[model samples]
Target: MGFFPDLPITTERLTLRPFTRGDVDAVLDYRGREDVALYLFDAPLSREECALAVQQRILQTSWSEEGDKIVLAAVLSESDTLIGELSLIWRSEDARQGEIGWIFHPDHHGRGYATEAAGALFDLGFQGADLHRIFARCDARNGSSWRLMERLGMRREAHFREHALFKGGWDEEFVYAVLRREWRNGG
Candidate 1:
């Protein structure tokens, strides 16, 4: 059941592991949706090139001095199909603080896959990575993301008005962060 026998993290319903070149079509298929891409990223990525870029990023993590980035493919635990992606990008200067992001296929959106994957990753961050804080940023307009953050027990720390530039204009963001102490305290 270990799709990533070499990697140090896995979950009952997911596998968080290094990306591969073969993931091009699936990654592109998810990234291709305008609704999924607009609020999440600045631009749409070209399928093959972007997949290669993602692969290169994971490869570079092997040599990273502080292990600031982890890009994981969220595969189904049962079938091992790559359903989506989850990531933790640490800010090296912040000790153990990191930010997380996730995306699933539109068909899988409301089925609690995000919550399951994130909860598993949060534990992986706290216990496996020894991270102190892991957070997620969601657009204020994205009610689904906001609700997901709450369901995951992440408290809203800040709401930035026009926090990011998207498609030549400004957009607001809700920043949610959870600390090690809070997680330990059952927050």
Candidate 2:
């Protein structure tokens, strides 16, 4: 399938590429932090778990089927530092839609790295993958995530109150989406 690229996608200051074994330490460094895992569905990972997660992501970098998920490591071009990650989950082949998500090291926050990486993922989903629509969701309390989604020109489509049990309690969720036509029209 033409769903994935073997080469890394380079942005002005970042490079979006597949995860490698060498990236485990960086992954654990960030993903192991409580702040980073606060909004995530899973708890903070240990060193071994982070290694396995990296291996899983590396495996997902190649998309041989319609439902394959693509996960990219966002590295700072200047330093080649793995600062964060961006992902596009193939939601429906029939609907031509996908879902996106992201995470970054707390140390890399406030630098616009997440937004830049996410925008690249959006372009890949809509233009590269020829998807009809792309959407993202985050806990309602994740102001930074939702704000970045907005900055990427995604419209807030829904706010599900107490959508599901998260972290042992009910939490609201915000959904943001953008259509291919909208993206092409500079949405």
Highest lDDT among the candidates is held by which one? 2
Task: Give a tens-digit lDDT track for model 2, residues 1-187.
Answer: 4476655999999999999999999999999989889999989999999999999998777555666889999999999999989889888888888899999998989988888888888888877888899999999999999999888889999999997999999999999999988984843
| Model 2 TM-score relative to the real fold | 0.95
Candidate 1 C-alpha lDDT tens digits along 87-117:
7776653476767788887877887888888
Clashes of each: 0, 0
Off by over 4 Å in 2: 184-187
